[model samples]
Target: MQQTAYLPLALALAGMLLSGPVLAHSEQHAAQHSAAIVKEQKPWGIAGEPGQVSRTIEIGMSDQMRFSPDQLEVMQGETIRFVHRNQGKLLHEFVLGTQADLDAHAALMAKFPGMQHDEPYMAHVAPGQSGEIIWTFNRAGEFDFACLIAGHYQAGMVGRIRVLTN
Candidate 1:
């Protein structure tokens, strides 16, 4: 009779304990959303509107550490929707930024290989999955996009983007 009375209390305590981890996970996801908003306002370019897209480009990633048509050219002020397809058997990402930014991010990724983060200019694509990122080339300069998945970057999984003036 005493054991039965304690059962409800025990289950209640267990439920509370389990909810702590779930709450933490939710907070982490919220943080990622905030970071993405911050990224959208940064100098690389504002988040492009789908209706304003000047062109659409399809890019493919493979386990061989290569991107199809790895080099791209766009005019300044052009908005592009990049359709990224992962053909690899492993996890891949498409991150767009300058060489310096990519190098910094890659170094950080190497240190925390299991870290999960997102930005407006980044897409995390799984094997045989597709992802999209809409970006505008507001500045006239050279930029880079790469998969900064630990050893993936070291294996030469990088591409170039050049924004030229009209």
Candidate 2:
């Protein structure tokens, strides 16, 4: 009877310990899914088909708060592949949106530093790592790409993309 009583207590303790990580994983997964849904709904641009990529633009992110070729001009309805490489020794992200959207997102990021999420319009790159974002600029206007990592955006880590009429 002593062993039986201890068994329930031990199992309860194990469950408590295991549940923390499991719950955290679930929360992260949910946040990522939410982000994807929002991305799909918003009209920044549509996800580009891999077969429809018209050109590839390689961008490099660095510790100096900058992106190579910060200004991009694309024709409306053109699809482009953005290859992002993190050449810096810090975590960085390439998020594409309008200036207003980026500002709001950066504020949210500053408020919740631990927030974890991903979408097709965002590439979270670690130091010396690389990622890609393929997008179709069906809308004609100006968009932006920025590293909204707290102080990074304030430090001039921003790029512009202008979609021109074909």
Candidate 3:
């Protein structure tokens, strides 16, 4: 008798579910209005927008041997602000380059602890120190950034920058 009593309740549940999808179609009307607004707005700003330091890039290095962001991008002649913090026990340097240039510069920097690279966009932050490097991308290309500290680069303290064409 109890089992039979459940049959009507189950049938009501089935009917409700069958009609549930039809009720959901009404939501499509509200979503279409928002989609139209998105199609008209450019979140990244309009084309030909001026490139400047409307913000800064904050990065952190740690004692465990890591960089907050191992990759970056910039535009030609755009001033980028780097707020780098050395959260590590040792020193770190943000040196920019191509693989070949880094290899060559690394070799030359071997003689000196902090003086060998030619291309700019380099900064060395000591432990517990905060440093900054502001540079404008003058060319469009990919560049490698690495910490030239004694054995840090070998341990993989490197990143890349994709500077887009102006």
Candidate 4:
């Protein structure tokens, strides 16, 4: 009977202890959710509206760390619908950013192999599957796209995009 009395207290204590991590996870999730709702303008450009897409470009990703038609050219203010088809056996992602930004992100990905991120300029594709990113090239400059999946970036799974001024 006395032992049964302690069960409730022990359960409460356990619940309190576990709540810390649960709260942390909830906070992290909330932050990520809020970030998704707020679109920040990047140096490359802003996210494109699906209805405003000017053209569509299909890109292929393979296990060999290569992107078919790796070089791309776009005119400023053009909204592009980037369709990414992953031909490789591994999971892949297409992330558009400046070279420096991609390099930094790659380093982070190498350190945290299981990190999860989402943005308008990124598309995570599964093997034998497809994903897409609709982006507007409002800024005229050279930018980069890459698969910053752990060692994928190091293996040269990167591409170049040239946004010509209109």
**In lDDT terms, which candidate is top?**
4
What TM-score would each prediction reach against the true structure? 0.78, 0.78, 0.60, 0.80
Best of the candidates, TM-score: 4
Screening candidate 1 with a backbone cut-off below 3 angstroms (N, C-alpha, C), the clashing residue pairs are none
What's model 1's TM-score?
0.78
Give the whole-model CA lDDT for all candidates, comma-separated: 0.86, 0.86, 0.65, 0.89
Q: Cα miss at 18, model 2 (Å)?
A: 26
lDDT of 1: 0.86
Which run of 10 residues does model 2 get worst, by summed lDDT? 34-43
Model 1 misplacement above 4 A = 1-29, 32-39
The deviation in Å at residue 26 for candidate 4 is 11
Candidate 3 per-residue lDDT over residues 1-166, each given as its tens digit: 9999999999999878854543453354346434532222121121122255645788888776678898887775566777789998887877665688667656545634544322235677889998876555666777777877767777777887787876
Cα deviation of 123 in candidate 1 (Å)?
A: 0.4
Summing lDDT over every window of 10 consecutive residues in candidate 1, give the lowest-scoring window: 35-44
Error of 2 at 63 (Å): 0.4
Task: Residues 97-164, candidate 2: write the lDDT tens digits.
Answer: 98999998898778666666577788889999999988988898888999999999999999999999
Better of 1 and 4 by lDDT: 4
Tell me the lDDT of model 2 at 50.
78
Can you list the residue pairs that collide in candidate 2?
Answer: none
